[model samples]
Target: MTSALRVLLLCHSFNSLTQRLYVELRALGHTLSVELDIAERVTEDAIELFQPQLVIAPFLKRRIPESVWSRLPCLVVHPGPPGDRGPSALDWAVLDERADWGVTVLQANAEFDAGPIWDHDLVAMRPASKGSLYRREVAEAAVQAVLRAVARLAEGGAIAPVAAAATAQTWRPSMPQSARCISWQRDDTARVLAKLRSADGQPGVADNLFGHACHLSDGHAASAALLVTLPPGAPGELLARRDGALLRRTVDGAVWIGQARAASACGEGKPFKLPAALAFAAEAQRLPELPASLERPDDEWGELRYRESGPPGARLGCLSFDFHNGAMSTGQCEQLLAALREVKRRDTQVLMLLGGDDFFSNGIHLNCIEAAAYRTGDSAADESWRNINAMDDVALELIMTTDRLTVAVLRGNAGAGGAFLALAADEVWAHRGVVLNAHYKNMGNLYGSEYWTYLLPRRLGSDDARALMQRRLPLGATEAKRIGLIDRCVDAETGAKAADFESGAIANGLALALSHNLAQRIAAKHQARAADEACRPLAAYRQDELSRMHRNFYGFDPSYHVARYHFVHKLPQAWTPRHLAVHRERGTAA
Candidate 1:
């Protein structure tokens, strides 16, 4: 009980929750191993090989086998309040617009999620998608609950079983199409948004677009300004299009649908969740396209937006890109590049690249690339090439800029090429809770080309940079700062208060812009960039990196493609990655 628990994580996939728990457990000095919950046999094999003191199911689709839980101490993280049971916990919460929710870590039992209570954390709900809530609030609460549960076990405390519900209301059944189905003619904006929010990531709400059967997702209400352009149309009629989303008329107002999955292509356990505009390409073109300005109404939805703040002489620019799941496709990359240029042209003394609060970026869109593979004359390989190159362009703008300081302000998690992209900034300010997977080897040994060769080595130096690249693990914010991967955290980097973190950091950032030595700092940055460029041009580093990436895209090795395909389609991994399954290593306990 005193020593670190030999913990084994059994998850459906290395999702956000699992990844957060892995990072947390590793940081807590626990010897950890991870195994995908592929099948009952595989889970048994992991248990046999790991001989773990505790098993944690952070995320899973199916229930754990009775054989294992009966013999071993195991905990399952359920995304629901105590007594609220089912696979569709979050879905039901969003559908019913529950005021609050909870995450429970309970001992595994014969019945699904009906285990003895260990610990739980509760919080009020936020207006966001199911995926966003899962990553941020629920995931954070689960961490606290799991940690508390482990401590409780360490204390040899007797945990009590879940109490019986007073009514049948606590029972959450698997939502059928009838439940999430949208009746555009009858459902108001609030009702429509709730349906879309509940089914954001998985089996989306059933609806037909362009007279074709499809499921709708990524919903946002149409901005008031956009209402002026609306024509007299039926409730279910498609009114206009913008930023790859379709504006559909509703009973009271319109809602913007960002993505969809065609029913016919739902076979073979494949997914084709494409941009709503792309999903109905032929029909979309027939509708009028709406143009949105970079600076618009606050409630409006757009992936890339720009805002300038602070006093006149020393102004700050915040360029926020809230891309869905932080997956940047070729077009998104280009859009970001153009936006960066526009923002740079302004007279702001500092620029903050504020990516979404849920995820900064996970690199190129694998789903987009996977969708590309099915189209005529298009290959996932080619999409990879274009997307990476476009990403490089955005990174280049960050690296080459010398007029003002650039800061990558991360409010959420960042991975793969996205981690490197943040490095292109003069400094990076991350939230205390941020987790960064700064390596690319996991994604089929991706060499990765976001000028990482030039950026990482310069920041961390050659030896440590190479070590980090090969480590194949996530770096917590504190550890990342210790390793010089980031500049500041909740603490001040530019002499700002860290009490409110992001807000305090932003206030301090403006102070940094107005600092007396700001000009000197900018001059030094410019000189340093010029010196680096002279020694090894960014183009040279980029060309070298892209040369290797070209092979990853077009070469004989199909590892990247295969890995990406499974990842995009949400395929269950057959085996745990060797890097994560430390128990399987020789000389370790078996």
Candidate 2:
């Protein structure tokens, strides 16, 4: 193992990649501090204060200062192969249909992404959005490449020069609106999907919706029933609206646009992403509505789903909720509560809550809450109350389910209220690569709800629970298991491949495993519930948690509201928090 060094993390935002690197590096015994890529003076001050031996830039929007790079060794993680260099690397790769991609850990130089390559790890590309690919494939490859680069630096090893790009491997310019505009009169469903998928998260596909210009996101191919219901006036015509999405006809088929941001909502005519129907309420209400339930084969684009397996009395029930960005809005929480209730009515011996592929849940919908302030003349506080109450209802339902064994199979990362919501289940199963942030203090010291005060102490004792909450650090699957937060951590090898974690094959294996020995599991679950209820009623637990959460929502202290606003609006951070910027704290490691 390399000796520990004082490392500085400089990034545009404390994004997923930055968080993962922070946790992993800390685990390896390195002292770390973070500084956002704001002004050049701020960067200089951080460097001088922290006095870092090495700096790592996981994500950056602007160029690094030449002064700092010339003084100390800096490593830059570019989301492309060694021969590739550009601002729109991932975008062009997806649009151009590249089969293989990689993350390159190179040194900082005069030209961007043209530094000597310390290490690089290639990954096979899948048909996914640039955002999804970055979160999953790019993230995985980045960890490997970054670690290799760091190790090389520690050992003072020679770095390899980046090979010259062939004529075919020219620079990819920033994707323009012309390339993103969908030609409803000419493009087929596949072509349209590719364009939208390329721009899924950032600068969404610029297109016309309801005769108004808006950026389209969360695009999915329309189901057969949806395609049939359209009036067929012309291509690009809004066909129908269901759940929170609107269906638009394409040349061959149609696409279900789950969410859209109008060109007139907020900020320089760039609106934050809102549900398609909500953004165009008047127009969407006129379109035909489809059922949100997954029971219908024709249904598409709903956030929540339900399924049942196994035989007779020994059955397994699976309830999956795939909210965009894993956010549970007030309506989404209510729909999920109803689904959970219906699943309870079944005779299933075991129940599994399958969250989305990207995220299990990140707590209440901050974007939706923020939208309420502008859309409806209501305060964000009011919307927050409703959303939290709905989330509690869903958790209370699962907590009170004594008849069947409940399992929260986390296919993706769970944070804040979402992590506690998962704890409401009897058993928590997570994939190897999953990250869990159980604490809520990171959100401006907001005390969380979802019966965490009751759920956490039961799983982990009072002392460990308190420490876990105060840490405000991301927990990897193994550490979470060790701390008793998760019951089991399944390695990615149990499935067909490691990537099957994204496909939910781990959840399938979990269901099958429970089915093999379900009778005992259900009986034990019932007995444990009876014991816990006898000691203290579940109602008391809910009351206590809600009492505290009530303060977080409506208390005179407006820190939560202030924090929520800044987060939803994507405000730039003034400085790194003391928790992350260890250099600012006393008792610095030397």
Per-residue lDDT of 407 in model 1: 92
Best by lDDT: 1
lDDT of each: 0.84, 0.79
| Per-residue lDDT value at 312 in model 1 | 83
**Candidate 2 clashes between residue pairs 3 or more apart in a chain or in different chains:** none
TM-score of each: 0.95, 0.92
Summarize candidate 1's per-residue lDDT along 121-168 as a digit string, tens digits. Answer: 885677778987887778778888898777665556544433432133
What is the TM-score of candidate 2?
A: 0.92
lDDT of 1: 0.84
TM-score for candidate 1, please give it: 0.95
Which is the leading candidate under TM-score? 1
Q: Model 1 RMSD to the real structure?
A: 3.1
Question: Which residue pairs in model 1 clash with each other?
Answer: none
